[model samples]
Target chain A: MKLSDLLETAREDAPAARYTVDDVVAAGRRRKRRRNTGWAIAALLAVFAVIGLPQLIARPAAPPATPPPPKAGPFDLLFSSYRSGDLRVGDPEWVSLTNQLASIGREVSPGVYRSVGRLVLYPAGSVPQTFWMSHPKEPAGAINGHEASFMPLGRSALIKADTLLTWRNADGSMVLMASFENRLSREEMVRLATAFRTTSPRPARLPFAISWVPSTMRLVAVDVSRPEAATALVTPDRPDIGFELEPLYEQAQFVSAWSEPGLNSAPQPIGLSFPRSTPGNASAPSGGIVIGVQRSFVSGTGPTPKCAPWSGQHNVRQCVAAPDASSNLVARAGHDVPQADLERVAAAGRIVGTPGDPEAWPTARESFPASAWVER
Target chain B: MSDKEAEFREFVGGQMEALRGLAYLTCGDWQLAEDAVLGALARLYGKWGRVENPQAYARSAVVRAAIDETRRPWWRREQSHGDAMPDIVARDEILNIDDRVHLRQALLRVPVKHRAVLVLRFLEGLSVPQTAAALRCPEGTVKAYTSRGLDTLRRILGADLSIDERLEARHEAV
Candidate 1:
């Protein structure tokens, strides 16, 4: 038989598929939900970590509580599904940043720079819902006779860039919907909030671990769904330092740790030393340190690590390539951190479990040494 | 249903069988092939609205995912239907069945990259450039793998394989 005939016949006896289109759609929806929430949570965390949270801690008090509306429309379907069009609706994913909630959004354009209309659902008795319930709310008209309260706030009351619509569900759950960049009108925000639905809650996961951390730092934010990154910001010692953590290995295998100056202080360390990533006309952050692990294939076993400086701009990072060349671990310390101490921190890192299996990797909370974590 | 979802369903319904067949050939086991296709399709579903040509995306993704499945440690994959070579038996009266079994064995014997090249070039009717694009390799590398794969098959089959080499030659000429 000809080669084509042989190839065709070889695949003929394969069994029927074990999954259906619906199964694929369902999985897709879950992934989309997880990924969307992951990005928003990461952004919120980045803001708090990099910019500092003194303003949040200094709130005088929430204004007097507003009475609940007499009636509200059913919003059960909004969380369970998606909306498409000029204002494309996204799936809801669980948020565990400060409180347990399911966060969802609708966007005008699905790009990084585009504004997303935000909706956060807090379960009854959650800290955020209770705190929000204590605050006075502005009447923003009604949605199908259900009274809605509007607040001019962004992710939180501290950043007042967005217009927020708040209300209570029949189940005593609290819903806060914000129109980012004023992309959605007050009426649109009310309508979206009224039509909102709920889906299964999905919690994010951390990709890497840290066995040691300085006493002054704490993990303030994490984005686990898509890029799988976390940030631990330093407090008290100096408000300017923070660590950016992510998985470095291909296919999200090896977890890594990076450090930089405060968000408002300077360009991120990665952008400085790596020209390909350099932000426009940005200067390197001074008095900052960075540590990361990079995965690469090298022939042979038990090769000693070779540590050296990078050839790129800023000329920072003392890197130690693994003996097998399977990975490269680097420590870049500015004047703030002693070089020896930075090396000690870098030395504490070791890849755990089977390299490629994500399940085998330790949880972000589990990956770090107990001493490394500081509760706020 | 949203048009995005309906479109994805139609695409999946139409392409599911062909993709399964492609994946099975790429990875030598049915179970691994199925897993690879499902994983690829699940990811594709998330990007359904954005991906301009999902068939091309699914084809490349399935092929690569199948390759990745093969890279899993042998002991781990042993729980599944492993790719252990079968013993050669005497030629039977059922010539088609015997030839198919023999052909499968021979195909597995070829190196994975070369085997992938052969599958893409022959079964999928992809030209050297198209195979190169699918496999993300140079066209010259595709030609070389095709030659090496054909040689391996010829040595095992113990026959001069009669297949059109004209497509490769024609593309090379262009």
Candidate 2:
């Protein structure tokens, strides 16, 4: 019999599915309750952190004889500020920055702030601008002594000439000021950069942070299944397109998740083929697809890597290894968002807070609040 | 309940049977397929409003869950009904029934992903692009899987009936 005939027979002979609508509705309600419980626990934790209840509950025995290994970086002092949750939306410092930038645009939405990150969007006429700040990978260099980088947004050339200005605070925190309208002058940007200040450190919770966000998108939802695996969803103001930032446990997982399926089901001979050639050097093996390469990492072991990221239409996944080599961060986008933008955003993923604590990151629902969206 | 909940329930009711069938084709076991479908439906219910294409998303989730189920240690230990192939029928007595049983047995032997591609492309009648979106893989991969899955099924069915002959007959019938 023909393949189509067999498939048709299978479909026709399939057993009757036995499930009631009530069964599904009950399951959904249970899921909602569990999700709400998770949020409640997170909120309680935030309250406890704010009230210093952990200290009051259990006073620690006095100091160690050895001075704690000198804090790793100058930013260590700023960790307390992050922990205190003092950098949140209503903080005087953030309020002052918002007020100072009011001339350019009004705050159209409530800001989303974590211990080490802050995101606030402003609408100026047809353009959507954002004020974002987070701890930098390293101390940011000064742009004319103001600790900022001002350059044209490099993702697209046809898109209007938009500029991005990012600067560092005294405590090693970095702020990103970008204008989609291409109207912010360098002098005005520098003046705005000077207004940021280092507030007192407080205990705060921030699950994860991304170094770069696309001009048209805002951080929406973050779902942390575990510390090593978190998914951040981003949607544009207009809701035409959205994407996710997914953290896989290892490079192998990233490769398997992204790899393209081969042309045949039978295992193809293990080899490499370059489908897309590199731009400059014809001989340089770049941009071509790699097929069935075995990954040698502590966490990966299997035949035929199944989840590697390969090029695809509509969806593009770009993965980069974390600095510690413990995990891979993948940025995935669909529906009109360019690959260059995804790669830049993926490259900018930064892990803040304790690496493995599930509580450090916000749940999916909490990350994207109703107030976060600003209608066009 | 709420309007959103009612909407989600209606969607689940409409899509459940098809998704369950898809899951069964992928896993080759009724009980496991049910579990996968239920798990996927529960997750879909949670994100009903947020998901752009609930049907496509549900299909992907079911496929992933089915694949995940096969990886579990218990999956190998479980004795599915397909584990024991039915008694072979006489050559002409019940040829159609025999073919169906043999087809199912052959499908059980096929790899998880190849089986998934076949079920989605042919059984569900999803376009290459739609199948790719459902599987969250490249379209090229789906095309390849389709070719390979059919080839595997052809090999398992018999050497007497060439794939060319079957295709010619199918085309003539159409």
Candidate 3:
């Protein structure tokens, strides 16, 4: 066969595309928005450096407010179910564990979930939709006499190799064991894979509740580090204005987008009393609204419950600081929605449980608006 | 859909498959190839009207994206559950499937850069200058890579595929 014919044949049996054209358009809009936002931030920083910083420096420095009592770290709830002190949940160094972008794994044991790196557990049977890159599989000998294999979990330009071992548990659930920093050898990985077991599915919970969202928006994706961290991306049904709905998630330092597949279609019904038009959002279309809510870990001395316009070029955003300043709720809309309405939605953000107690936290269904719950 | 969106959809419909094939040849992984195409096409969608030659831009972008996919952190790589052989050509072949599979395996053994050059020149049938433009490398580098890539393939297949000498001489004299 001609080399060209062989090349054509190689791509002949590709699986059906997992994403739709609309998803592509939506992602493009988001990328464009992110680029625009990055430029805007750069410009704002330049202005701040040129004009804003000098005035601040020239002013008398106020004494730092007495620090509020140290609060629980954002990931405290992730370890809520584990009664044992043996498993360290979130260490300063483990921050790399949360950067998988979109990864999910099942709970292997109580307080011991096996996700990308962090032990944060995902609901059983959930699979990642977008595998960011292709991993070429290689053979690793059997583990515990059951068929087993391992794949290098590093990028093409790998510096420290990570390996992922997979084997079938007698219970039929696949057990995935990953090594971090190349610390575990092939034998150690196999041993862990052989020993690990997955427990029955447990629902993930959140530390905060969003009692309201704009009527038109729906929950699309969620990134949660159980017990302490959670963020959800909620946008309208329209695909055309996805750029206007780009996540302001970066506002919260801990959370990232859950790139899980099929999560986008999991929209819950939203009950509505919100008007179609609001004062500051006159130009914002109802279909262009996006709302993001995150459990805040930053401690500030500012007065409770402040709402102000957030940044964006084509959208109006209102970031409402929770009463305890323990969570951040940001509402965004195309240039048409009234800013007051967006504020009202953001201000509805409520901390539903003690920051350090995972058992006290609400399940996603309980915490999110009726429309934002993603049924597993 | 607006006129711009309609135009983009039409372009995607026409070129998506060809782009996928090109990316697969470049990256040697179907999943990664699809990802590269999707990403490149999405970027194309963002610049739909502004890009003067969408076809060329997409071809270059898909190849570049596919290469980048190989460089991404392993943590971001997909985890397959099965113990399948490496590079299992998808299961739709009928005629000379073994030959195609062997050629593909041999082609992958060529270094990624040289392999990219070979695919563009021989498979995509681009001239040395065109391949260099697509790869953002100099013409001489393209020529050298093409020669090195063909030599490697000849060694692996042990087949005298001297047909490219004429093509190379013609381009070298230009």
Candidate 4:
């Protein structure tokens, strides 16, 4: 009748889970789609404000054509959903008095139309790249008879040699076209911008999933250029602690890897003994390391380990390896956290699935094979 | 099916029962417990790859979601329907069943924060710092809440014998 026993008894009569996995997945996808739609619209509006376009209440008449529009690109269908008056299309601060022109401005080429508050483009690829359209200090020039502003590609760390292209819409609205992956020259940028048409925004999906979130922590940002290497930033209610999760592709390589120089070089060895009595007791390598001021512990031969070692200069960390020797999970806390507590956190590690497919691990009480006693 | 989807389904299937139980213990209502667990699971599904410790994260999420449900206006409006205490026969049986029922009722009387601390610490076997981390509070707060919560439960149960002593005795008998 230990306290643990009482707690277990209290929950013995708990009801079964009513919802299925498919239901939860569906709900998650729906929520993500809604959030992505909002982001896409916001991005479109921000792009419009760069070139100094007036807000339009109604769709204006098409201007007289000067040149034939170019043929529609492969991605035209993806960009055709946006139109004028689609949720406050233009920003007031960007209104250009001198460049005020007819609404539904002339088509610079086939499939491309310049309107008061819209410039739609259908890029060929399905994958979206980060595009920056404006830099405050950059100089302006003319492209395809429209005043254009340009920013060098090296301006952003994520972009290499590409250039950002911005031009005034025929109705005086601004348009920007830039791609990090494809470096387009001034003429190509102009041609592509002139041949753009709006398409429906697709639902956004995260390449990776977060099976776990610390209590009181809200997911603030996600970086997923590669699904296997995705990272999630979570901010706790307390401002003092910062938490992030990144995949450890190879647990053994990391565990055996050399620690950074100029940091504490001493290896503080800690031991986690596996009890033979527990179910599914996998024989793991007995040794563990509590390295540096972070005190990150990496152990176990499991495929997917639950550990999150603080990436920065934090003094306390708990890293655990899965039973399969594939990936490691690292959790970092501030130096204020006691060493004993950090060990306990490390010992609490559980493996869900491989890095390629992260599932929720079984609870420690049910699946933690053998009681783990920490040895200093 | 995609590998990610298949993996997610396996995770959900394995952990659903435990999460539901934890949620039920925290919220004291089956329906709300289910809602809290499902909500947390849905969120976890969206973040499956980025989470480091999915079990810990799921537990923390379930607890927080349950706590959040109690604070809602609708949750507050619903009256708590207390469970009927089992009829006591032998003195030992009373100590086992009736005492548990009494302790549970006392737990509900404790403040939400204190109750959460008690449940996480005594029930989930989380360390002081781990409980603090899960609740997003300081270790000192967790220690204080634990002390106060146990005292409140002790008073509510109104047992002349120390609960610990009785539990120990019961264990030895078993």
Instruction: Give per-candidate clash totals.
Output: 9, 23, 19, 39
Encode model 1's per-residue lDDT on A201-223: one tens digit a residue. Answer: 33333334556656543433332
- Candidate 4 chain A lowest-lDDT run of ten: A92-101
- Rank all candidate structures by their TM-score, best first, as comma-separated numbers: 3, 1, 2, 4
TM-score of each: 0.39, 0.37, 0.39, 0.36
Rank candidates, lDDT, best first. 1, 3, 2, 4
Order of quality (DockQ): 1, 4, 3, 2
- i-RMS for every candidate: 1.5, 3.1, 2.6, 3.3
Give the DockQ (2 decimals) of all models.
0.44, 0.22, 0.24, 0.25
A103-220 per-residue lDDT for model 3 (tens digits): 2222345434343332212222423221412356667777667687666764333222366655654543343444545545676555444444433334445556777776766554
TM-score of 1: 0.39
Q: What lDDT would candidate 2 get against the real structure? A: 0.49
Assess the local accuracy of residue A354 in candidate 1 as a C-alpha lDDT between 0 and 100: 47
lDDT of 4 by residue, B49-88 (tens): 8999888898889889988887889646555454356545
How well is each residue in A113-228 modelled by candidate 2, as lDDT tens digits?
A: 21211222221121222221222233335644655565554334333325556654443444445443544456555554555454432222234455455555644333211233
Q: Give the best candidate by TM-score.
A: 3
TM-score of model 4's chain A: 0.29
Q: Which candidate model has the greater TM-score, 2 or 4?
A: 2
Compose the digit string of candidate 3's lDDT tens values, residues B1-174: 799998888788788878888888888887888889888988887799999899989998998898888788989988765535465566655656666677778878888888888778776667888888999999999989988988898899787665455555665675
Best by DockQ: 1
